[model samples]
Target chain A: MDLIQKGKNYLLEDNFQIRASDNYVNIVSYDKMIHFDNKEVKIQYRNKVITVIGDKLVVSKLVSDEVLVCGMIQKIEFR
Target chain B: MKHYIEVRIEGKNIYRFLKRLNQAKINLYHIRYHGINQAYIKILKEDYEKIQDLKTIYDIKITNWYGIEKGKKIIFKYRFFLLFFLFGLALFIFLSHIVFDVEVVHNDKKLRLLLQEELKKYGISKYHFKKNYDEINKIKKEILYRYRNNIEWLEIKEVGVKYVVRVEERIISKEKEKRPIQNIVSKHNAIILSIDAEEGEIIKNINDYVKPGDVIISGEILLNDKIQKRVSAKGKVYGEVWYKTTVEYPLFYQEQKITGKTKKGWSLSLLNKRIELFSFSPFRHKKIFSKPILKSNLLPISLNYERQKELLIIEEALTKEEALEKAISYARDKIQKSLLEKEKIIDIKKLKVDQNNSKIIVELFVTVYQQIGMEKKIEEIKKDVRDH
Candidate 1:
């Protein structure tokens, strides 16, 4: 149809989004938090699972956009 | 906008509680984990109940609070003190603009009473609201103008809540003080008609002719033509004096008598142009007495009360004899006004009369008996006993 409608459909339709920086990770459209601890946090969206491994990792902010984990982030693994 | 607060949540399943909070659309900020099971998070104050409902599944304890709720609790705790402080500040501002007492600085009781009355009329009395600088200056000017002969200088000073009025009385300077040992000299070359001496020896008798500067009443108390003591010569020495006056009388006289019907109204004047308000019935011949109500110093515009009194004019064609009699009376009045209260007019002799155009000019010699005593200090001769 139109470009704006296509963009709205893209935003509304089920899609997983993740942003990771040196100190924090922001995730959007996640199903739930599978596990959370001092050293790592695991989140699952649809049929996929995302793993965040870090030191002193904590959920700094949370909204409908899943969670934002902040700390010394070493690596992120998705399966 | 909802106010958010930072609270510490203590529970065994803290992570599960955060997940449930996010699912409920409750936003959290600045989260920190003290331990694995205990975490601190920020949430909106209204959403605290949802977190409380999860207490059955987990043991939830609130450790601290923050933001708008914290501020509201602190304000509610000291609301009474804040109210009293605000009320006190408002009262201070109101009391500063009120006058509690008026103090008039003067020694004379009558003068103080008069000034107080004048100040009361100008709205500067006790318990009145304080006036600004310009208004006070205007009031001072009005009072000075109303009592110009009574007050020479006036000052209105404000000290805290009191109005202190300082005034100076206008004392009319009288004649210079007479010496203790002085003589009353004849002021003019006349015949002394009467003498009333309060102190001193009478040197000249009644009906005696005297010249100017001649001592009529002496201060020296003499016994057998020898001086004993001296005193001030205080008395009224009545003498007959003459005046040569020429008065011009009109052949036709028009006397204006006020009918006593006076009308007072407002008048606005711009420069030399005046406009009277509510002047439906006008007086044909009127004498207007006006006092300014509002005057502009910068512009030539003023508003004043115009008190107009109706004048009744009586016109009469005078004959030669009537004109001459009127002229003699006018001359007698002129000389009589110059005399004191006790002084009397003895006679008026017409010397000459001449008709000029529409009037007659009469030359008259007027005789008035008045006090002619003027004090003259005596020169005392000091003969030193050591020189003798």
Candidate 2:
């Protein structure tokens, strides 16, 4: 009905999304984050799980539905 | 939505504070670990306000603000300077298009005043907006047409912030048919060499000697010793005229030689007073060249450059031959200027040369063949006859 609601509906179509680069990690439409530390972070969305392992891991941006992580990222696993 | 503010958090468990902020759905960016018990993080303004509820768990303080808010503060501080700069620019643009002076370029006082008045009627006076080329041309045509008899040609030119109007006056020549009967008389005492009559009868022949005011051609037409009609006399009468001239020349002359020493300086001249902008010259004699910074006649400001040159005055004596030649040529030139354009120097003879203490004086007699006829109105002749 409104512009903001329409945009939210489009972004939330996917249950969860994970994008990782050399120094940054972005998670979109995630339900919640389970564990976070300097070496590893675990996020939960729908019926799946996402884990990120890096050195000096810092949460740069955190919102209701999106998360941005920045560090010397080493590996990322999903289940 | 991304209004960032640097916040310093002081607590033993910084990680716990960060995790709580993340769980609260606050957007955080650029989080840095300052020390074991303190950390710095950038967050949105809205999120920072919401995080105040957790002040009991952690000590929080905002260190700095960034982005658009900082730019707004700086602009507000220097608002006066910005307004003054804009006002100055507007004034400069407005003044550049205004005419400060209107100059009518003419030698006659009456014509200059007439043109000035005419231009004023067209709104082209001082402090008025300068007209474009097309408007100036239209105004020129209108003025010329209004005073067709008085003005033969007109032009308007823009120089700097001034307008220059140039005009030429029309002169009406008198018609010859309306003039009275006249005779061609001798203007000088000379012997007639030849004659060419255009509208009059030749009265004098070649080799005939005539005095001043004597008639060389007659305006009266005769038929069998009877007066028929009268007309204006016109003719050219060539004759041999003589002149005697004397000239004196100095034997010794003093000349200046430049020593090539020069000094450059600037000066400003206003009316009759001049102020030097640079240092004064040590040399006594110098030449000055000035160029105006503002090329307007109403503004008397200019930049003057003075060049000082050293002069050496030396006296030199002329030889006898040189002195005699100088005196002779001076006398001849003086006599030659009085002759007509078609005249030629028939003979030149030296009468005498008197050498004084410092100068030589020469006297010469020159003979030239030239036109010696001039018109005399019949009414003037009748007045002279009645007086006699």
Candidate 3:
């Protein structure tokens, strides 16, 4: 059981995972949301920055390890 | 995990408050801003307690409880109605399996009563719970086997909530003809035309004129002129018989004619009572035909259709020839009904014709070739011999 848990942790070693679709954006293991508004959302994870630009963007779900952004997504950028 | 509370946070810095709540690891869902200063958020009931620290920074109030808590509240409020609905459903299911009526279909009263008793012995009477198909079939076999000599076939059918038992009774054929000491006597005053003796001596010859009581066939058997034995006499004796019949007919006859006016209606028949479901017939003179629509065999209720047709009555005068022909045919029909199976009319002659006020009366003599023999017991003949 210990070996299985360590292997699972290694497979999920990525600090932040970002997924974007036609109308929504989902980010997992994000450090914090630096900016959130109607037009854009800026998120910070580890040492990288992720930005989501959309219209009428709303935070549909916000939890400890993940956030779900919904509504009319236009672009996404990572730096 | 499913219980939730809708909280409305009213403050100038609601976004900052949301960020702070997210930092505090508070899960929020379905977050919507009502205006610039007020926003609504749904959170788990357990997580709602953690938002107490934000009371100093923003005003938070629980608007409503949802999910399982809301369902529990509504159920508690209408508990009596739910209980009654469940009880009614259970009663309906239970009553559907009960047999309200048992019907034994038979024309003979004694047989019907016997079958009813037999069915009762198997607990298949009224007010009993209906048995399943396999059990009913088993009971049917058992009963049929018990009365195999009397019952030809048996069937138990369920119609709605009633059980209808249809039974076919065994028909035993008649026993063979018994030969007793008997004699064949003339049934009418006639002249014997032919005689064929099958089991006895022919006492009367052809062209013999005899009365109703004359013996046509003798049951006595003789050897050397002594009565050796006596047997029942069986013979076919054909004779020429005469009948006088009088028939009368009015010159004017009234007949009913259909006028083609029709009306259709429906009725409900329960037991021996009938209730009309539609309007009655408007025509005064009409013929009515009723037919029942059977929805189920177990239920006594049935829908019936009644069709009524209007008729017209008309009178017409008959001619002389028509009146005589009609009178003769009416007389012939009356005589035909009384004739035996092998008897036939040979000839008819008009004896007299007379006319009264408005009717004509015709008298005729009809000749018929008929079996004129009938059996007479031989014991009566022996009694006469002993008395003499």
Ordered by lDDT, highest first, the candidates read 3, 1, 2
DockQ (C-alpha) of model 1? 0.40
The model with the greater lDDT, 2 or 3, is: 3
lDDT of 2 by residue, B1-388 (tens): 5677888999878777777887887766767777657878888887888889865668899876779966765677778987888898898878878899999998999999988988999989999988888899899999999999899999898889898888899887756557569999999999999898998788799999999889989898888988688988898999999888777889997778887876666677777787777564455544555555543467766666655556767877998679888777776676678666888888888899888999988888878898999999978987988998
**Each candidate's TM vs. the true structure?**
0.50, 0.47, 0.49
Q: Model 3 Cα displacement at B327 (Å)?
A: 49
- Who wins the TM-score comparison? 1
For model 3, what is the alpha-carbon lDDT of residue B302? 88
lDDT of 1 by residue, B243-358 (tens): 78889999999999999999988889999998888899889889989898999999999999999999999999999899999898887777778777999899889999999888
What is the C-alpha lDDT profile of model 1 across A1-79, one tens digit per residue? Answer: 6888779758784457788899999987788778777688998887788999999888888876558888899999999
Across all models, the iRMS values in order are 1.7, 1.9, 1.3
After TM-score superposition, the amount by which residue B235's alpha carbon in candidate 1 deviates from its true location, in angstroms, is: 5.7
Number of the candidate with higher lDDT, 1 or 3 = 3
lDDT of 3 at B91: 95
Ranking by TM-score: 1, 3, 2
Worst 10 residues of 2 chain B by lDDT: B287-296
What lDDT score belongs to each candidate, Candidate 1 first?
0.85, 0.82, 0.86
